[model samples]
Target: MKKDQNDRDSAIIIPFPGLKDRYYEKGISSLESHHFQEAVDFLKQAYQMDSTDPHISAAYLAALYENGNYDDSKRMAEELLKSGIGSFYDVLDIYLMILIQLNDYKQVVATLKPLFEENEIPPEKAEHFLQLLKLSEKAVRNQVMENSPKDDIPFLHQEQSPQDQLIGLGMLKDKNIHPYLDSLIEMLSVEKVHPFIKTAILSLFKENKIDQSILVEKLGKKETLNPMDIPSAEEFPFFHLVKNQMESQLRDHNPVLLEQILDMIERHSLCLYPFEWEPTNPSVWTAAYRAMGYELYGENWNLEKLAEFHSVQEAELGTIFTFIVKLEEISSAIVSPQ
Candidate 1:
């Protein structure tokens, strides 16, 4: 439960730790030594201390590019150039370096042509800049970044989220959501789409109070969703409904048992998200409580008592419990111990 909660909260950006004056020398030294990670770690703090300091910003930008944080480097470079952090020429050079590394040759060609035409380039660096412009022109001529078959994966969680589809979802936030409904529906219909991406789509729909009908599928289950009526992530299905039912059964009698059961519900919710344990029966998870209580805690959670309380047949509950054990195992594998 705690681990899953933390994952949901990971979206909040964490800035670099504070640094005192003169500490950026440490970062400069790291950059000189080619220890890119150490350089980013140290210089970002110095950059935070005084973003106006061109020397610190330039070193940090170099570190980020070398560390393969092209997105961060790209953003920093754009800011420096747009705002004239110190000198337009100096920042423009770093910005071009980042764009080349990202293979955004189109942007490189677009940016440099104007600069060269206006005689903006320094004589000493003009030849070097011209070579980059020609290189990018070649790639752009080949139509790179234009005819790519897949979406551009975001820099955040690029290892797991290899495609940039999530950016589409982010764009939908606070929008009408009607114009893009067809695009979203098509994305969901593709079988190759990742579960995490699909979850983000539905969660966004639910968050924005969407009223449209959309088809949703998982494992082998399929349903038409009207997200306006369902629970959002804040009021997650299990935590909203089944949790109250289970608590009613316990009647505040055993804090330890209640805690253990809530943990199971949270784990199951995390494992099965964008979906929840359904039929929303108190008996199903009440039965889970009875079984896991025995298996994990060595307590005799009477099956007959649980069945009687929930007004379900013991035989049927046992059958459901049989599948629950397998489901529980799969759920455990997804939520590794933190």
Candidate 2:
């Protein structure tokens, strides 16, 4: 897909003898195609050849920004501004954007206020800058309020437990939290830690899209297997029978069978009503159905509608659905009270 024209325009292309034209063209093509990593790779080559070229630097910065490498992008933008190579307003715009993503609101205010006072902002961009300025000021105020000292007497103050502190730290929105993530992860991985605290830490990592394989290993759990590798109904006679019955009902389009399968699932405690599960062992089909069902219906689930929304063929959906049911049954049986 072609990137928006504004993004293309934001990639300022200054010419330099050292960097080959072909590299610049390839970099721009990758950026247009929305292949950000490829764009970064190409643009970095072009940049190394001629670091002084504003156009090359800008394109590299944009690629870094697109790839969520805000720190690198910010550094490149600052370098460009310091060198006085690119259009000042353009470099400042990219710098401001990086600051916003990094949540350095105070720096944003500091950076923009001078530009605004000096009337350096172009007419078209003035309003956008003003909006960003206002937002930065508000964020700064909110940060002050969040960090303000409380007036409560020391004798009356209740101390938070280590687990509560971990949870609170995980929930904080400050950019300074980076310095503490490793320590928090270490604390969270201790086997003696409360399960709920471990869960909270895991959730925080998941929410930020951070890899948790290290923490997973530290917990002494077996490595997560590919869903396809998990044993299914073929290994369990009772589950196979249940699967056959569900398939027969689905083949007939008998909606009543939905309730029967749900009842079986509930009895086995394989899945909670409304279909939620930990992201652990299960067949691919089971995981797919659960994810699609949750996204479509959330807690208020409707299986038939979910199947329809995904345009799932009757046979395929039914097979997957039954497989999930059987998978859940096996899972519950393994963990159930003896």
Candidate 3:
């Protein structure tokens, strides 16, 4: 999460009653205005003052989720989903978003299933769900492809930007890590992981010192192996490199800068051979990549673009519009300019 000037200068929150609603309103307005830290502080006060208020609790959960507080957000989101009242669709969207933020794609798909079946989801909505699923699948595939080249069988250490890393770690540390990651891998084998997720995993490994290869190997062996391994090995270096990139980004306190940098990348991005991004507006493509978080930005970039180049040509676009967030983090950093 990016720190703001005011946030750094602000004293610790001192809670008092009768101020919850005011804070809540302020928080919502702040969020709308992209004044995230102030929003968090205010919403937090509201939640503290009236712990039972679903409104306050929901806002708090959303704030935490956006700010990269995954575990707390996840716990709170589940609780809110379980006991709250609002648009079921809204709640489901938020829940799926939380799972996405945590890099827990399995749950994301699982969580969305009932929503689809229960409502007889419209084709448009189903298509969107499928698109998300495809993206998730592509992300995982990108991870496996990225790591496929490591000779020693690089651990499943994920490399993500700081905020994303936190969310990924939360997923990995979840009581259900084994099954959860395993399920994702299985899905990857069958449906293939998204390049974005793959980039995210690679970035996660590069940033943190955690030995995740063991866990990764365990999951890989427990799952499936490609008949061809060379391609996978080639993909491994990206994981670490991408992670390093995001960790560096975490220090920036300015996501907008990264977004600007990405804009530069899109402008100059080459469409080499069959691997090219030929979108009329490169900005949208960049947006989707940004959505996967900055850490994974360059991971499947060349290869996926190559694939996209051949398959979609003019239709292909980047992933940011579909995924990566931390807008508050970026905007906060913008305001503070660290």
Candidate 4:
């Protein structure tokens, strides 16, 4: 059984039994040559042949991210972290670069918090994270100011202890948590929160908090969405999964293709498709449709289009929603076809 599994796991080649050292060297060489995809494939083979090859797996993850295999890359990174090996820190260091490109600040913060808690970070490494956190803090603030300020509050982790809170809050406050501003108010409301922390948070919130009723009126309150309707990232498909499906739909535009796309939108609880329609590559038409907010997640949709499509039947929404479900379900079924 062991021999059969090993044979099955080995990378196929003309000779049928490729030397492990040769494949490992080739993968490293491919990475140096900037052949990211080829390097990923070869490194993956080396990984399978010897799961102990920590360096190979790290290199594979780098190549995977560079080659735009974000899902696999992320999975590999997470697997390394969870596998309880010292090498995962090295993998995470490289994975952070990809997260930066994806604008995934929340994940970066989450990943950083663990290392901070463990006090495992060196000064040079700590400085790099600090710089990234600064950029992320600014980006998040701009996003809130330009768009939905209320929505951004959810990204704040209320469960964090005072020490963990200080590191993240310091980043959020841009290193000057002084003089108390309205921004910190929401941070104070939690029960059992430290008095010092509460004082700091209360000062910020009091400064920023406007009259809720008046603000709502000024914003033109109509039918407000239930807070329960908000979609969390954890509840949706991985961003790359939606991106892959949307790209597939774009590559072939027909009613059948459109149906496939709509199916994907519906299945992922209407969240994944929103980001999917808007990819990193703007040259693709999917980005245009996504930018138009055709398949926005629960909310954060463009107002003009929302009005135009508001009266559109809920059944259509159901159809699209189920299409996504069907896509996931069907794909899984096929993989384990009965």
Candidate 5:
């Protein structure tokens, strides 16, 4: 019975036996589908079966790279270069990309220098290589400056006042200002931050096109709060209604409505405090906008008085007030209890 069982097993022929091509085909298909990890799995199997095949090696290396297995990809690329197999420049490009990601700019510079001097880089690729070389050189210089002695830093000796710091930050060239973005945002979010600093930070964010929705929302909430830190909704029903509508629009990601709200605040600010708009003192923009709702709607001023205060025609003020009424109706309809 044991002999018969062995004979039956031997008779059972495995389909597609030793066919590494099948695994390579599946691996390439997965790679093309952007399933990098799946590609790596199949390609690794194919590599194991036919280790000498250049196509298998390249596909496996690419799969490894795309899957973010940089260490393995680098090792594979180095092996391919040492073996003098497949496309030398192609493998070198992959190796260089890995090094760039690893921030090994020195190695990148050393490797490319010899290739550039030997004129081995293809003309089509020469431009790209030069760009990488320039970026690497810049990165190396920045690293050196950062690692230099702390006492050599000029700003260390100079103590800047809050106002002076705000002015200095506002005057800094946009190209060199990205590193301070998080710090600026933090300052903007703090209610206790000097108005001048907040304004400087807002200008920077506006110039850089950083999303200011979070800052805008925080400022809006703070504007709604009274001196006692309680929401002023109980004292000003119209302001409360308008504020609720604005919050709903913001939650819905209605950019048009959000921009309209910002524009209203800005226009009101300009009208209420015309002389405060100074380029040198940017904090007035925030102060002006924050005071808009309270000064107009919260004060319960008549239409004529409101128009006169804003230096606008009664018709314009009436239209804006009517628009707010419409927004209130829409918000009520959506949020009304069933």
Candidate 6:
């Protein structure tokens, strides 16, 4: 659509059918050689002659992108996508990359959301799409917060409904949260606030590298935390440490046992999160999860083997596993998905 492109077209002689193939071959070679402008020139002619050819259209889109013609790249990609001229996902990916290069992050977020909700992303491409979704969302959130009239900190107050607080906290990610730090820490101290909300606040603080040392009170226990040095609130080590040890032990063989134990640990994570539980003895819990995993599969559940595998004493592993089972019974309601 440039004046030069139009001028080039005006000077072109009428081409026979075979000429388009020659143009395509040269265009693809130019693209591979990083001669983007030449690629664009040749591919544009090929695409104009055979717009229905998916291969030409795809190559033309790439050429336009490499030529730094993001607007035309996006337009061509969308047209190809709408006409079903190429692989749907491939065209979609090209369209998204164009949006990203143009810094049209809001559009990027809007485009990806439905694909995720409908489970339409191919399994092989899911990770790439998820990463794009996260990146765009952060960019969009920062932009929205920059233009907003008020910060979302007020939503963390005790009087607000948990749903509203959660909504507000969701808005707070990737922003300069320093102004809200005191309020966030105070919310953590308040016993009446939803435990889930408190956890979210702590996570936000931790992610932004809060510089101040602070006292955190949750589930009736108090600990002084330096936000920069600590894990994200959801990433508390007790929940993950046992799983890590199990991976070290059962990874080469008995992967089934390792996976089952990790699931058991995840269930416990859901139950105990934002609760004050810390693993003073990770070996005991690791052994406990292993025992329960073996029991569930009707496999041999030898106490000695479990303790030795986990480097915990046999009698102590038995005793603590009993206690953990009892703890899980009372905490069962917390892990229900809904």
Residue 307's lDDT in candidate 4? 29
What ranges in model 5 sit over 4 Å off?
Answer: 1-18, 144-211, 214-338
Across 226-307, the per-residue lDDT of candidate 4 in tens digits comes to: 2233233334444445455456645565433444444444433222211232223322323323333344333365433432
Give the local distance difference test score of model 2.
0.56
The runs of at least 3 residues in candidate 2 whose Cα sits more than 4 Å from the true structure, single-residue gaps closed, are 1-19, 144-338
CA lDDT, candidate 3, residue 50: 81
What is the per-residue lDDT of model 6 for residues 153-203, given as tens digits with 9 covering 90 to 100? 346546655544654565565666666666778877787776556666766
Task: Using TM-score, give the best candidate's number.
Answer: 6
| Deviation of model 3 at 22, angstroms | 0.9
Off by over 4 Å in 6: 1-167, 192-199, 231-241, 263-280, 295-338
Tens-digit lDDT track of model 1 for 66-130: 78898999998898888777667767776876776666778988999998999989886686577
Tens digits of per-residue lDDT for model 5 on 229-324?
Answer: 222222333333444545554536754444445545433332212122222222222222323444434654466664554455666555555544
Clashes of each: 1, 2, 46, 12, 0, 0
lDDT top scorer: 6
TM-score of 6: 0.43
Estimate every model's Cα lDDT from 0 to 1: 0.65, 0.56, 0.48, 0.50, 0.56, 0.72
1-338 per-residue lDDT for model 2 (tens digits): 88899889789766666456678778987776557999999999988877888788888888999888999999888888888987788778778877877878799899989988998888877876776676667567766433433321111112433322332333244434334455555644455543334444454554455543443322234343222333332343444444444455354674343334434443342222112233222333343344333443445655566556544554565665665555555444433321
After TM-score superposition, the amount by which residue 301's alpha carbon in candidate 1 deviates from its true location, in angstroms, is: 5.6
Measured by TM-score, how close is model 5 to the native structure?
A: 0.42
The TM-score of predicted model 4 comes to 0.38
Give the better candidate number (2 or 4) by TM-score: 2
In terms of lDDT, which candidate is stronger, 1 or 3? 1
lDDT agreement of model 5 with the native: 0.56
What is the TM-score of each predicted model, taking all chains together?
0.42, 0.40, 0.38, 0.38, 0.42, 0.43
lDDT, candidate 2, at 322: 63
